[model samples]
Each structure stands twice: as C-alpha cells, then as structure tokens.
Target chain A: MVKFFHHALKFRKDVCIGCSHCMNECPTQAIRIHGGKAELTDNRCIDCGKCYMVCPVGAIIVEADDLSRIFDYTHRVALIPNILLGQFPEGVSISQICSVLMEAGFTHIFEVEHGTRVLEDAMTKMMEEKELPRPLISTFCPAIVRLIQVRFPMFTDNLMLLKAPLDIAAMYYRRKLEEEGISPEDTGVFYITPCAAKIAAIKSPVGEESSPITGVINMDFIYNKIYTKVKQGLSGKGSCCLPAMQPLQPEEMVWSLTEGEAARMPGRTLAIDEVSNVIEFLEKMENEEISDIDFLELRACDQSCAGGILTSGNRFFTVERLRKRAEEAARGNDSMIYDTAGDSIRDHFDYLNEHLKVTQIKPRAMDKLDEDMEQAMLKMRKVQEIMKDLPYVDCGICGSPTCNSLAEDIVQGKAHVNQCIYVQKRWEQEGKLQPKESMEILKEIWGEDKF
Target chain B: MAERMQFEYNVDGGNFTRAGFASSEIKKILKKLNVDIGIVKRTVVATYEGEVNIVAHAYSGTIYVDIDTERIRINLKDEGPGIPDIDQAMEEGYSTASSQVREMGFGAGMGLPNMKKNADEMHITSEVDKGTEVEIVMFLNNKE
Candidate 1:
C-alpha cells in the first residue's frame, strides 16, 4: 500500500479483533476486511484518524513524538491548547499549568489560543480588505483540510490561506528565538495536540510551506503526569506570572467548542461538527449554495477540537468547564499573567514581521478510477448497472465498506459477488453452487486447507 | 451485462429531508463507475437542483436517468402547478417559492440557472396550472 499523507498513525495488527468497527466508521471507506483481518488501502485514506478513534481493541494507535528528543534543542517551547486549560481541576490557574510544564523541562510556554488570536486578527484584516474568497473556509482542523483536499478539490479556492493556529504559534516562537541568536535547527517548537490529524499536519502541512512544528506531543499521554506534578506541589507555590504575551480572551478560549468561531463572527455564518456532517455540508458547499455566507467553520470532531480522540476529558464536561472558566475570567476572578498594561504585549506582532507565511497550494486529488474522461464515464455507467442488481442494504458483509464499494471492487476484480451472504444464500437455494464451489470459497478465504 | 443503463426514481414532493437522496445515489453510482470527478460533480449539481425543484415546487415527480458512454441525461417531470412564464422563472432571483420552502434553504430561484450552468444542454417546458418537465444533458467526454 502507498504511504498516505504522513504516517502519523501506527497500526498494531496483533491486537486487532477483526470487529470491523474501524472499517465501517472510516469516512473515506479506506479500510477493508481481507481474510478476516482489517487492512487499510492507503490510496483513499485521508488520515482523518476516525479509524484510530473507532478501534475498540487498541489495535490502532497514533505515533507519539519521543519526549527525549525535546532535550536536543537549546530552546524548547511548548504550545498548549486552550482545551487543555479546561481539562484541569476547577481552581488550577493558567500560570499553575505553565509553571508545572516549565518544571517538567520546557524552556518556554506558548498558548495555542494566542495563535488563534493572531489568526482572528489576520482574518479580521482579510475580511475588512475583502482579500480572501467569499465563504472563507477554516483550516483549524487538519482533518477538514485533508478532506477538502481529497474529496472537495473544487473548493480549494474557498479555503482561507491561513494555516492552523499551532502552525502560527510555532512560527512565532521560532522567529522570536531566531532573533535572539538561536538557530532554527537549535530551537524546537512542540505542539501538545489533541488529535492525530494535527500530528499529520505537523508532519506535512497543507500548503507547500514547511511545517513549523519540531515535535508532536499527545495531550492525553501527559495529562496524568501534569496532574500529578501539579498536585504534588512541584510548581506554582504562589501566584505565578508570564511575561511573554497576553492570555486568551473568553471568546478566543472557547474556539474549541462547536460554533465557537461563528459566535464571534456575527453574520450569515455556518458551523458544522462531526465528520459525516462536515462531509454533507462540504458537498452542499461544493454546489455553491453557501455564497451568501461570510465564514464557514467545519470541524471533523464531535464537539470540535474539544472532543478529540486524544483528549482525556469528555467533550461536554470540558465545554461546561470552559464556560464557567470564561465567566470567571470575565469577572476578573482569575489571576493575571501577561503584562497587559505595558507595550510589551503589543510587540507580539514583531515576532511575525519577518516570518509571515507566503505560499500557494493546489488541489491534491486522491485517485481517479480511470484517466480518460470517456472511460471514466463508461466505468460509472457500468457501476450504475452493477448497482441495480445488488442488494441496496449497504451491508458490509462482503468485506467492502458499502454496496457501492463492493460494486467497485467487483469491477476492479478485487472482490467477487459471491462474497455477499445474500448472494450465497440465493445461490444455494437455486442449486447454483455445488459442493465443489463451496470448497472453492473455503479455499479462497482460508487458503488450501482440507476441511 | 447492461452496456447501456437507465435508472428511474420517483421523487415524492414535500419531503425536504429526502430530496437529495436520488441525486446522492446517482453520485455514488457515478463515483463507483470511476467517472471523472469534475463531470460527476457537475452532474450531481444539476441532478440535485432538479430533485430539489420537484420536492420544493411540485406535488409529485418522476426522474429518469439515461446513461451511455458519452453522456448522462436526466429528465425530470412533475405533476403540479407549472411555471406560467418559463423565461421569468429562468432568470436569477426570480422565485415563486413560498416563505416556508425559502426558509428551509430550498428555493432561491437558482435551480434552473444552475442546472443550465452545469449541464451541457438544458431544456424546460411547462404549462400553466398543469405541470413542468426539465431535461439536462451532460457530456461525459467534455473538458469544460
């Protein structure tokens, strides 16, 4: 199988229970059952990590960056997700979390929400200038970017030129270090991500520009370590402070929640969460029905990034916690970190002055069944003809993802119609299959073994 | 094996949720057949607009799909009050959709124009208080 996207996810075939959960849940229908085991067809995979989320037996795993590599860089900057602030207990301050992370061996801490604020400012500028395409699509979620690249290639123009917030944070941190006499090769920017798709993005960014991230750290992997470190009083003995940049606003912190972006953009906007829902919306968007809208945010996770596969807490609980925290922060209950009264916070843009992203990206289509348009049309007509005869139940008993998949597999000579249980039963009732034919099927499935 | 395939679907009117079902099915079939994605996308746009037109305007309708090696022709016929002025209805922003259908994002008067834009050939004939029939033909071999 061809290597799809970045190999951000690893598979352990030893623990696979052959439940087919991952196969059925895949949005791209990339997984198929072969010889009672699940196999991924890398050509169609967008590396969305739904298979990793759906695997019940712990067979599918995301490849986590080795924490030991962080020591190799002279300056190691950790980028924290806003959702992580809500993952902690009710009383833990942002300073406390940063202190614990610093104690845990990080040289500098950069909040992902700061990157979000930067993007909001840039996007606001773009909106005011009308520089971007209408109905601007967000690149916050890497899975959504890959989805658009693979499935909705025609909507590539609608995608906003801005990269993910982590990318922005990494760029900011690296530039600041580079100006301070630190080389790019000597400085590391680590993103504590909540999903495999972000890891994929860190490995291979959407545009032609190089990825800014040096290492991809899984959130849930270090959740308990940070919790224990904070509980044991390893750091934050008193009120702590940060002199780097400003803290995230209430509206900015909730960007991980569903419709969080739309809540800020007051217009005919649309927000869709969940992979299937986003796919449907993208299909509709591809038809150009959403031109009346200004912004469209499509998230692949259940409750946006808060409900990611690597998150330790439930999505609803995290959102509720964030809501309460945002309320308290609004009332000035939380301790202040960054020096908001001085001009130092305003100098944050100085970091991006020389490192602003300037690149172009074109559509990278997944695959074409046939190269010739006329031959492709003939193939489609043939699929329509084949589909009329098969059962329309979409039963995955044939080892394909859907009945349409089975039809394609048959046409591609990868599968036979007899693999369908319904076909087998009908054949048996009609005396179409002899004892010899049944043995042939057994040999095909289990290999030349006498039973 | 059927060298030439034709699919017929009866589109029930007033079922907004199910309006795109036939078109979605057609998309899946076209995708499975390995059709050019651009052509598949155009066919889906035209076919879906036609299907939605039936669900939003007509009481009941029948859609016939004729596919060969060269083209996929979709003809939609409905049994309901038809457009009185076909030219006026063809114009952009000219809609007779009720507030209920418009609120559901079904009718923006972009259906016929979009169908015409996507399909290589389009023909619409209607009679007042009778019914309307729409035919869209998309060439499979065209680059545009």
Candidate 2:
C-alpha cells in the first residue's frame, strides 16, 4: 500500500513536454518521465516547488484556494508573510498594500512574522534545556521539514517540535477574534503563501492535526492583484475598512531571511539555505562527520523565503528591500506610517505559549525498499543485481531519474530492466531483442506521439 | 534465512576529504534495507570513526561490509605503523596522532573508543610494524 502525501504542486500532463528538466533538477529524484509526462512519487515529493521553477511550459501549478473563498465567513483575515511586502517597488507603501488587501475583500490583515517574536523566547528556553538533542533544527521551512522526514529520517528527532510563525500568528489572530465575540466558524483566516510547501503544510501539517489557517492564496496571485491595483492608481486611500497595520519589530521583519532564526538563537548556530546545500550538509551530519552545533536553520530556498518559487520579485532585490525595511524598523522610522493594530501579542504570550508546541513528527522514510527487513534485504540484492547491466550514466532515458533509481524501480516491479537503452543496444547486438520490439518499449515509456 | 549482501570500499590514507565515503555508502545500503534507524546511526558512527582512523594513521585500507537479516558486520583492514600499546590507544584522550592531523580535527584519540561505544561487538588486532584490523558488528534486532 502506497502512503499518500498531500502535495500542493499539481502536474498537468497535457502541458508537460516530457523534456525531463524537472526530473533532472529534482533534489529528491521524486519525478520520473512516463507516457511523455512527468509523474510525481507522492511519498518522495517534499513540495519544494523546484520543479515548478524549472518547468518551461508552466505546466506545474501550485494549488491555491480561490479568492472567493474568503467571502464564506463574516470576518476574513489575510495572514501574510513579511516577504510579501518586499515584493512591491519602494514607491508602493505598506499602507497601500494593506488597503489593496482590504479592497480584495479581507476585513483584517496580519503579518506572519509577528509570531516569531513569541517563538524567539520559546526557542531560547528550548536551547537552555540540557537534555534535548544538540543542534536543534528549526521547523520554519515546511519543505526542509518534509525533506528531513523522507530523506534523512534519523534527524527527525532533532527537529524542534514547535509551530512555525505562520501557525502561531494564525492561532494568535484567531484567538484575538474569538475574544472579540466572533465565532470560530464565522472567522476565516487565509494565508498568502510564498511557496507550495506552505500550502501543503497548511493542508496536511506534519506534526499537528490540522492548521488554524482556513485557506491559502499563492503569493504570486495576490502580488499580481495588488500590483495591478497599485499601478492603476486605484488603491482605496483612507478606506473605511483600512486595517490599523502594526509596525513589526526589526528582528521579526527579517525572520524569514537566511540566518534569521539562527542569529536569534542562544548558542552556536549555523544557517544553511538551498535544498542541495542542505542535503549535502545533512548527509555529512548523518554520517556523524559534523558535530557540536547548537542549532541549525535550514531553508529550502536559496535566500530563504525571498527565493520562494511563487515570489514575483528578484530574490536579491527582495532580500535587499527586506533588509532595508528591517533597518528602518530598527531606527523607529516606520512608527509614524501606521496606527497601532491592537493589543500586542505579548499581552497574550502565556496563552499562545501554551499552544506553541506541536506533537512529535513521525519519520516517513521513503528510502526503505520494503517494510519487512527480510523482504527489503532481498529487494536490495535484486536492485544490485539489476544495476550490474546498467550504464550508470543517469541519462533519464529509462524514465527514472538515475540508473540506480531505475534498477530500484525494476526490482520493486514498477519498471523493466530492458528500459535501459544500454541494455537494449546490448541485447540487439546479441540478437536477443529485435529493433522493432525495442522501439515499442520506447514508445511505451515515452508515449506514441513522442516517436 | 535471507541472502547476505557484501560490499567493499577502498579508503586512501591521509585523504581527509574522502574519509566518510565508505560509511556514507554503507549508511545508504542499511537505510534502503529498512534497518532500524538506531542501528543505522550506531553502525555509521562506528564505521566513520574507523574510516577516519585509517585515514589519519594508516597507509591504505579497505572496508568490507556484510549485511544479513540479523546483523551488520564491518571489518576495516589497513596497512600502517600499527598500535604498539593497544590499551593506551583505546584510552579516551591518549593521542599518537601528529600535530598536523589534530589541526585537521581528525585525531582526538577518540577513534577506537567511539567505535567500541557504538558497536555491539568490537575486536582489534594489530602488529607492531605491519598493520591493524578492526571489526565491528551491530545487531539489527536489539538496539542500545
């Protein structure tokens, strides 16, 4: 039985050209070319959105809730990350963005990073505990958390089982609304996400039973809507529904950038970004080659959330804009720009802290060939035996990501050993397989139209 | 009875950059075979320390890995100036490593002790002038 992992990335077979770009670039080798399309292994995909970035035909779509979903509740709140503010040009003020969100049918707006302030204190407390594992890994990036679960299962214990800023913020905001006499069903909290992994996390959270967030709108979609409104000089200034935007603290403003959490932690910490870099570092860490670190801030994207696949701005520019905003907040220059939103989250710190923890995240190891030890060992030998004839070129012509993966697939009964072009050539020369039969195999793997 | 899988990886002496290669390959194999994660962790730690010992102290070495349903057994054989005082070498802080090797973080004299701590069964054999051989076995069923 195959376990189903909810992925926000959806592949449209009609638009995929089977060019194999996504298969080649996937960090986990989760994609395989089949029937002239890219097929995703549900358990293997971490929903990092790397394939979405590399697709030439825009076939890979990040699933998002329809904007109309916000109208379902009486009190609609837009929970947005700080990186969303960095998407706009310097000319567009934060006030203008809030007004546009209000114009887009949201009754309230809240920054996700506000939850980090609450998390920072809890993290420091966690670091002070002598009994926990060394080098506690942050659970900020959903993609990195899922990556660790599927690829490096041993490190799952090292993950700090705390809610991410988005979750904390959502919980805080929902509680605030509840205190204001709004029923839970009447309040809808929609997160404007910068990546598919965030959507997946919201839909099928790893440790927690379910997310407090009611829906997710992709950052790119909201960015386009706000940018278009801003450009047309249609941002409703002084609208009656304008939210009293709270000025985020400097540290909170830059919490999603690289080294954001690591710099705030108590002890020696290292921040590594980009999926491939994280994988390399983790492999060494798993081998016990690296040790004695206090905390690890691992982000799937290069510049952290600024480099999210759904982000519209240039990653470097987004980082620069966010850093500038942080500096301005540090200087107290933004205090005059917006009014106080409401009671500070610190006022409810104790209540929020009580709900801050997530249950232990179970490791769903994708590398295991079988559940039974004996069967897995037998499959291992069969994969090795099949690998003997492979060219080891990792051409992806066999539809699997690498020659080794093809062998594993063959042993698992998902693929045939003859799918290898090298094996087909050898067999043809040996007069064992006819050329027409080999061509038929290619058609079966690649599709009839491909020929 | 399950069929056993055998693998051998060569480790070049003094190659710090490639010290974890054999252990990493073996780790991948154990993971694919659905071995208990605790067993995998201990096995890799022991293999890594042993591999690094060969790199920091030996001329050359080969790691022979044998895996069955019950347990994983690894033997590391290397040609080098072997341990004259095996008891002292197994001490936590005792060091025969050169100053250069210490600077590279390879030799803290914790190699043999770390292997012994992680492995369920460990054995050492050495000749004063010829070589050293270390064998470690970790059971798949019972975990520490």
Candidate 3:
C-alpha cells in the first residue's frame, strides 16, 4: 500500500442530497451512490475538483485549513495573493490592503506577487540549459495539475519545477522573518487566497511539502475589511513600486496577467484562458497534434488571477486597467530580479519535495476486480437479450443520460431495463412488452414510474 | 455494420439541464465493470460530446455504447441533416454549435478532434439526405 499524505474526499453529509452528483461528475469513479449517499473509494481519487465543481447543492467541499487553527501560534504572517488587490473598491492602495491584514490580527503582511519575482529569477536560471518539453504546461493551477496526474500523466514533465506564487511567497516571508531571528517553530505563515484549490494545494502540495506557509484565510471573509480600510485611506503613505519590506523587479510585476509565465521565459509559448478551455487544449496536446507550440500558459480562471471566484472587481475592466499599469511600471526598469543574500538564506532551512514519496498502487486485474465477473457478464447478456426484444428510442425521459447508459444502469442495479422509451414504445407497438412483474420493479425504483 | 454492443439513450434535446445524464451513467457503468480508467474517460467524453452535439445541433439522436473485454466503443447517430464535408468537420478550430450552446461554456471546436484523439480507432459515415453515424473504438490495452 502506498502511503498518501492527503485526506480522502470530505463530504458535508448535511449538504449532500444523495443526488449522485459527485458520483456522476467524478472522472476517476472514486465515488459511488450507495444507500442514497455518495460513498468514496479509498486510494482511487486523484483529488481533482471535478466533483467539487459539479455538485448542485454544494454537497462536497475539499479539506481546507481554518485560519482559526493558526491562532495557537505566537507570530503569524499573512501572504496575500495579488488577485486580492482588485477585490476591493476604488481608492484602495496596496498599503491600505496590507494594513487591513495587520489589523485583522496578522503581525506582518507580504504581497505574493513579489514572491513571483524571486521565482522568475530561479526559473529563468533553471531553464537556461534545459531541453524542456514543447508547450511546457504551467504548474500554477493545482486543480489542473491533479487532473493531469489522473487523466494526462504523460504531460506531467511539461510542468515547471518551480513552486507557485503562494509557496514562493511563503519562502520569501519565512526567510525574511528568520533573518530577523524569529524561530520557525514560533512563526506561522498563512496564505490569504482567492479559491478553494489553493487551500487544497497547501494542505497536500503536489511537488513539494513542508510548505513555507502554514494555513489559509478565506478571501471571502476578509474582503470587506480590506476594502473598507483602503476606501477610508486609513493606511500610511507608501509607494506601490517600493515597499518597506523589499523591492520587486518589473518582470515579477508582469506575472499578474494570463501569459505572464511565458513572457518571462525565453521560448515559443501559448497562453490558454479558462479552465474548461484548457481541458480541450490538453487533449490536442496529448494527441501529438499541437506540436508547434513550445510553452503553454494555462490559467484555470479566465483573465488570469483577475477572474478568480473570490475577486470583487468586474474582470474585464480590471484586467485591462491592470495590464496598462504593469506596462507603464516596467518601461524604465532593467535590473536583475534576484538577490545575492538568497544564497545563504536558502541553506538555513530544510526543504523537501513532499510529493516525491507519493506513489500509486496498481489496481487488481480485471478478472479479480469482482468475484462476480460471471454474474456481471450474465447481467450484461440479459440486458442485451432484452434490448433485442425492446424498442430502441433512447430518450432520457427515463432519467438516465441515454438508452445505453440506462441499460448499463439497469445491470448495475441503478435502474430497471424497462425504462427505455423505446421499450415502452415497443410495448405499445406490440401490445405486450410491459408484463406486470417488470413494471412493478420499475415503479419500485423510480417513483411514479410509467413505462 | 460491424458487430456493436448496441445501447441507446433518449436525449432530451429541449432540456439543457438533462444534457450530460447519459455520459454520467455510462461513466458509472464503466467504473463498476473495472474498465480501464483511460478507456472509461475516453468513452464518456466521446459519448457526452456526441450526445450534446445531437441534442444541441442535430434535432436529436441516440448514443450507443459497445464494450467487450478487448475494447470499448461509442456510436452517436442523429436523424438530422448530415454534415457537408466530414474532413472539414474534423478540423480542430471548426464548430457548428449554437449561441445557446456557447453560453453553456462549450463549443471550443475541439470536441470532434478530442474524441478522435482519445479513441484508438474511429469510423464515421454519413449521407446528406439521411442521418449521420459516428463510431469510435478504444482498445483496452493498446498503445496509441
């Protein structure tokens, strides 16, 4: 058995309506509808949020850090995602945003966008002599990365080895705090994030572990406070260009947009907008048809971080204005973004890639999958034999997706074979397909069942 | 026609809400059978894509799923006016989806190509006057 460091699918049983929504949406089939409840199979799920996205009644929620958990620590740092900057209303300066975090019980606050500067420098150096895959995929979307592990394992190498904005920011903050003589044991770093995916990533990171950050504060909860402070101009004056904590290079600032990753790297690149669109593009890449593209910038949300579900601004106008701001800011700067102090700083901490130890156990052989392969085969054969005697109209008025899906459901004990619209049509056509016993079964399973 | 496993689905062409019901159910059946995850996914994608295309584009159609120990197959047959050119239809950036379909966040022009890419073998035959038929086969253990 492989030792997985993450928790299994966490279901809020109260919210779950037993609609089989998660079971239907899950790509790995890790979930099943049993006894009118969604049951998850241990060790099968890849932690992709497909089920999380598709639940109708908000039944499923991923395991996330409650910021209240970090209250036990003496000192805490809030590493805020840059997207949170736009979540406030007009006149909110970066200073006011930082101040609200300080006001909301954080000892210190750092912009994660600044962390992108350090990461860009490190990544550029790493890619200098590399023969990386054409159309190298962005590792930024944790949900997308998990999707790759389950559905597109062949494309894993296309991901950049560099850590994401939160991790890199956490690293920069921890180092700065440690240099000031703060002990790692006493300091806790929490990511103020825009989505549930980041919380999942922090708790069970894909590539690395012992994350620089300790937990997350829901951006939804803190948005109003930060906005109110920024609106009231409560914070002291400070240049957005030069913060007192540290200076970020122009290249790092550009990473706020969609293709920002490829813009910083030297190569052919493609930036795909929207999570749903990336799914189709990845399929093309898998087929070896989109070989012309060299690097891919895949943003889960449309308009990059600007369109995160937690952001308060209108995405189109904000993205346009932010782009203009970034271009103007970058015009005069030509300095290298990394620090020489980072060398001694990198050595003091113990860094480990948490996912290095992750391994998947092989599934049992097909014959051994169920002791009743013969029984299943009998059920299938019966389904087919019944299909030959029935009408073929597949209309899902029967509640399944198609006639075939219904027949399979019937075999699997989810539905009765007589639900096919054609079967009813055949009974009407021949005046005999619906004998009483099967009608009773259909009525028993599907209330108000009319065949 | 080649020997097909022969299953049918009644697509609610008028209801956008019931669109992927068939695909979801097929996914479940494949899972219970201990089908290869890759094959199960490919079948589901092709099945849903075809089913959606029929419901949204063609007036309506029946989606068929055929599976054996050796391979899994999907055939989506619609009784609507057929494609003008099958080759042009196979292009990655081509789409015939409606505005209503696009609002649902689909119609990327990648559906047909994605289905083809995922399946190891595919055969499509259609006539302008009659209905169109698409057959896709993904072998259980074969490398593409």
iRMSD, per candidate, in listed order: 4.0, 0.9, 7.8
Which parts of model 2 are misplaced by more than 4 Å? A2-4, A239-246, A340-342
Candidate 1 lDDT over A1-451, as tens digits, reads: 4454775777676777666888899998888876556788765677678898878888988887877778998788888888887787767767788777776678877777766766776666656656666787777787887787777766677777776677777777777777788888989888898898888877877674688888988898767777887788776774443545655677767877888777766457888999999998876665554458888888999988888888988788888988886777777764547665633323676565344453555655654555554565566666667787689888787778788888778876788888766777778878997656865764454334324
lDDT of 2 by residue, A1-451 (tens): 5664789999999899998899999999999988889999988999998999999999999999999999999999999898998998889888888888988899988889889989999999999999999889999999999999999999999999999999999999999989989999999999999999999999999889888999999999999999999899998485534344466889888999999999999878999999999999999999889998999999999999999999999999999999998898798886225567657888889999999999998888999998888899888888878989999899999999899999999988999999999999999999999999999989888889988
- Candidate 2 vs candidate 3: the TM-score winner is 2
**Residue B89 in candidate 2 has what lDDT?**
93
Put the candidates in DockQ order, highest first.
2, 1, 3
Candidate with the greatest TM-score versus the true structure: 2
List, residue by residue over B62-93, the lDDT tens digit for candidate 3.
88877666677778888877888989888997
Q: Who wins the lDDT comparison?
A: 2
TM-score of 2: 0.98
Q: How would you encode candidate 3's per-residue C-alpha lDDT over A11-114 as one tens digit per residue?
A: 77666666666665555455654334566654446555556657888777655567676777777777776567655544555566665676667776666776
- Tens-place lDDT per residue, model 2, B6-117, is 9999999989998999999999998998898878999999999999999998999999999888889999999999999899999998888899999987788888999999
What's the TM for model 1?
0.88
lDDT of each: 0.76, 0.91, 0.63
What TM-score, computed on C-alpha atoms, does each candidate reach? Answer: 0.88, 0.98, 0.60
